[model samples]
Target chain A: MSETGVIHDIGYQRYTGPRLGRGAGIGALYVHGLRAAFGLGRSAKAKIFPWLVASVALLVAVIVAAIKSQFSEFTFSYVDLDDQLSWMIIFFVAILAPTLVSRDLRSNTLPLYFSRPLRAADYVAAKFLAMVTAVWLLLGVPQFIMFLGAAFTTKTGFKGVWHEIQDLVPAWGYSLLWALLFTSIGLLIASLTGKQAFAAGGIVAVFLMTTPVVAVLAQLPSTTANHLAGLTSPITLINGVGSWALDGSIGFDIGRYGPIYAIEAFCLIVACLLLLLARYRKVSAL
Target chain B: MNIIATQALTKTYGGGVTALSDLTVQVEAGVIGLVGANGAGKSTFIKIMLGLIAPSSGSVRVFDIDPVTETDKVRARVGYMPENDCLPPDVSAAEFVTHLGRISGLPRTAARERASETLRHVGLYEERYRQIGGYSTGMKQRVKLAQALVHDPDLLLLDEPTNGLDPAGRDAMLALIHRIGAEFGISVVVCSHLLGEVERICDSLIAIQGGRLLRADRISSMTTASDVLAVEVSDGADELAVRLTEMGLAVTRDHRMLLVPMDSDDAYDRILRAVTELELHLHRLDQRRHRVAELFTAKETVDV
Candidate 1:
């Protein structure tokens, strides 16, 4: 600019400063990756999660009171045996993951991820794992305390949380196991679409909305419905936890110790792998 | 040798919307400009090279590595500043860069040191400790660039780095890009649609339209340099140009000026003789050089 402030920058030069090497660069990117991934997750929690989690918690609290009332002796069907908490988890996954992942992709904020040393798979892993931790903190902690209390009160075989874990190893393990499954599934669905609403709604429609109708419609006199309330295969662990909490015996129909855990593990792993592959495809396209 | 190369890298999304197609190009060193109109596939081609998007049926390589097969490795060598303002609004620039430096495998002390140096380089040292949410557009842009460079990549890919900046900010950013290539020894791919701006900085330029490579050449070489001269006259301009043309000098009339392609002292003397004979008052006579702006007209014929 001249003295009068009439700007003239014709001889301008670009930056030529030294930077990090490749090996060290990737490490820098990881730092960027974690902050970015967790930052988005935290923002989502602040914006959207309160309503879903609080509403569900309120419903569960009401049910807790209702069940302790005159309905104590009444026996509902196996379908009503659980309070659709698994479905609630599924709902949260469907809505939350898409809003978090897909919307960013659709709007072409991809450079936000790629510019750092962050890998596509690492981004996927961070998002998926963070979701798992989030669900565990929000859902598992509350449900786990209630489980230990219920187990001790019933005096079936355990005394406290520690005793309950030893006596009812099947319950807590399955609870965390389901948390992993739902988190992975949510991320997988979100990875495919570019819009949050579409991904979340698609998850709801496929696993929760249509899967249940299909299972129910598929049920017949000689034919048994495979899933109850479309509990994402991993949700059986929640059923396992609910079963142990209400009753003293934690083991189930599959076997004395082997519930549908292998199925849950298998699904969770497959979901994670699939999401990674999809993330790779997306990254390559960028 | 070209550090980044693309062979007809095409991308057609669902519903037949083509983001990029047949975009064959090459980039060697220095500050290269990628200029196009909005939705003109500058981002698409960059994404392909970054391995962030897969071309429909083509390929891209960066630093002797297939961006697809060696994405992690490729990303290691490439730093990117996106077009959009997308920092996590709550994080400090220093915090963000240090985190990325760690991810790029920097030791704790080095990451912190590198973050400070980068923020300083981008002139954001005062605001580096502040959250990005409160930063002005230019400060935010510097933070974006700081993260890209904190890792010390070999190439920097900046998408519309000057977007939303006032004149001063754009000039500062452009100067930084040039310096990165020349002083930092880092090749840069700076994307912009403003020909006047990129022409001033980029050593080379590539124009894209309708997902296709429209043109690629050095900004210094694209115009196929002619011996054209810009001549302005204070009086009798029209008569002077006519006299020069009649004198067998290829004189062309341009707005408020005349273009004379004189080759020898004799040819120059002939034009001077014509001007003197016509009694025209000459204001200035300057050589015309090749510039990216000169070929913007050619960019119109291709699809975006």
Candidate 2:
């Protein structure tokens, strides 16, 4: 402004165009969350951890397939693949869940999210779905590689390939279940704190630390006590349920305790989802 | 039409802390500054207006819709820049601002296009691709502003946007905000405890104290000039004051200046004559304008 108070024209055009509504807002958030989970649209360094874990899983599957192809007489199936790669899934969840939940909280960015045309439930739902998708990719892609590898290396020709393809039906179901369950529990834990180290460490402690304790507890003489002990580690609970569902011999003996493990796993999943909802509800209220 | 209106809006948090108490005011579309001291409920008022928090009682209407009930509607047309650092470190300014635009309901292509335009307008075109963690404080502030603008909101709720900038950066940010209001015609409600900058850029002000509305009026009315002219001389200010008094002009000494009542026909001429007669170097002679600080003090005493 000059001494005479004449305002100059600095061009800042008003937006007179069409603006999208609430559904588009929710959809955008879902896309952004999924991108952030895999470190897409971020720095190259930010992409390292997720890609490294994914690469390691892929490499293991390839190496396993190579060894199986070389030794044509050895027996292998997708159930055995899931058993062998269970720890990798646990590790993937521990490291990646924090990226989806903790970073936003740590930066106090909830106001930014809430200030948009989105409800708290929408924010939580989008994040949860993105997390499930990320975990599914991590766990499912390797199993897909294993399926393809198994079909090609089969000496029994089309019969062997058909059998392997049939086995993938159960494999994909189990992989999706693992994704849903781990996403719920991991996101619930990660939502508790903004500190990534603490969230990640806590997730690791819950998944890894409970394994040995559950093992010792399962050695009890009583059958009921052994079935109850399987409820401690998510890995064990999932394994127990898988054994019951598939009637396979991978981890625990189903015997009469199969239904008990399945019920406990279902309850745990529901509890984790409920806890996640409650945590986000409190944050939005504030 | 009023851009925002509150009817007996109050917010009382847990443990009996009242952040806002019965703040009822109407704000029109323009550069409106929300000024108050720290912990004076400025943030609380903003959150309620944005529908980020519910009021304990009463109602808030943004763009003529109840924020509590139609929060999504209100938020769809409003963009908010919070008082703290909220950008994720791992993302670049381009990505973060584009993501915010998407979150605000822009399509992917529109978000990307607007993100670049907004970043350029905020003078961050050169560093748009740099990670935000590497940005300076001024750059970070610009990034925050850019995100708020990327959505092309009808109104902007800026909570202490200039909190951490140096004088130069503060000047640039205030200028950008001023243009946003004046040129773009976006209704801006800038929350700041810094009264000077608010006074400089805002057309009207909503001043608060102790969780209550102190006053809301045009900046011109609040800062109307008093009937006094200040005279500053390089030397002999006391002599000048005495000489002015002798010349039948009521004068008072203030630091190195003489405050003469402009009750006469020629206040400026009288001061110039006195300075010329005394042969003292006249540094300045200007009318004593009322400031926002004086307005605040005046309102505080009036409330008492």
Candidate 3:
């Protein structure tokens, strides 16, 4: 053995690089939340539920595209696709909203996050934006498939594809409305609990349980109540807004209450978002 | 420069329970220990330092930045390991720490590199890729520490870093903390209820009781040698104690050893002469110093 062996200095090194500010923190959180919603960078078990719903949505889009190509007279527009897949969208939100918000609560990781440069508003905003984008992709991607199906079959050249683009853009907006409303409400419900099961169940219950109230309210022997009953449920509320603003009706009539539906949709989204921000103003004591 | 300074910091919840009452202290950069019992506002003090919760009244500054107004600026330079299970079970330690590093403002590649380096520094090398749920309490604590260090903050606020560890694990953790402070040149404030652990690793001590500052001083000053000599004999300790009392010195027997009060400069000579006259084999003789635990019990006795 050598008598003069030297000891290497492997001490902790200080990072002298540029440290980004709050914007970078929020952006990283947004990226992480979005990946988590789709179970990216997680175990195979985590990917099962998200991909199950996503695959089903993709399968339906393929079937719709095939059907539209086969039947030249088929009038199933891109907006109609979102209307038909509303239940899938609800299921997607139930699965996704909890994964985005409740996991942090369940694991009690908010303190670790808050102890950094990220603020509560930044946290809430990143999560909300992530869920919105996830839901929009779930709906918007399928609508694009339907457009592709129509555009390929059209013999009317570029103008036909341009027409398809026009229809697809409005349908994407309609899907965005669905994304915004469902995400805000679902995230608000999910944020209230740390247990993912309870949050998922509560979110599904809120969305499913309200549709019956709209049905019952529409039957009150008053035309005014029937026109205003869509406000009672988020599902019908979106349909009412779609029918009034996008001129896409899916068996729901808002009558002259188009502006009311628009205002209620807008107000409901704003209120849910505000409530989420308030809920996160202080993380759980743990 | 003082890393943390607080003046009349009071935090009263809505239920009228005061967590911190008029706490005023300034801590310099070193391995400082914050020692207190459960519910003694140690956690509350740390949270206020991190700006996690606002103080009900008064002012608090971390790194000379007001935590309440410039929370982000304060938090940017402070790494905190909370006193709870904050690790997500499903993710590996490497991924989780890297993610937190990114949130703490490191770019993507730097976060990954720092996460690996930190995990290795915390004595977690091959196990960094394993899921944290399968880790032992010691390994989990290492993961938590790794995340806190991955950001390379100027100061560290660790709350009960060795809370659920065995004796050997505790020793390893204390050694790591000591190295982190002494070698890494980063200031640390270790909040713990165990005074022995704090005294073993800290340069200064801050003791709190019932949301009040009991004492704040350097460990050296707090543990200065008391006017007592601890002597151990191979045998005949009882006779030695009796012989010491026969002289002017007061002696107290503690099991096999005798504690003699050093009242004069000749105390050691008197002890040596007593041992020689009694023909007892002197095994060990040393000055008895104050322990950090004495501060708490001493205050209790004064209160009574």
Q: By TM-score, who's the top model here?
A: 3
Q: What is the DockQ of each candidate?
A: 0.22, 0.63, 0.67
Model 1, residue A155: distance off in Å is: 17
> Candidate 3 chain A vs. true chain A: TM-score?
0.95
**What is candidate 2's CA lDDT for residue A207?**
85
**True contact recovery of candidate 1:** 0.42
Note the clash tally of each candidate.
52, 0, 0
Q: CAPRI verdict on model 1?
A: incorrect
Poorly placed runs, candidate 1 (over 4 Å)? A1-108, A115-119, A134-172, A185-237, A241-286, B5-26, B36-41, B53-60, B134-140, B164-168, B207-215, B222-229, B233-235, B239-250, B261-287, B290-304
Better of 2 and 3 by DockQ: 3
Residue A142, candidate 1: how far off, in angstroms? 8.6
Question: Which digits, one per residue and each the tens of the lDDT, describe model 3 over residues A73-149?
Answer: 87778878788888988888888888888989998899899899887889999999999999999888888887888
Q: Alpha-carbon interface RMSD of model 3?
A: 1.4
- Kept native contacts, fraction for each prediction: 0.42, 0.70, 0.75
**How high a TM-score does candidate 1 get?**
0.66
Q: Rank the candidates by TM-score, best first.
A: 3, 2, 1
Per-residue lDDT of B115-199 in model 2, one digit per residue for the tens?
A: 9888888889769998899999999999988888888889999999998899999999999999889887788999999998888
Clashes of 2: 0
For model 1, the DockQ equals 0.22
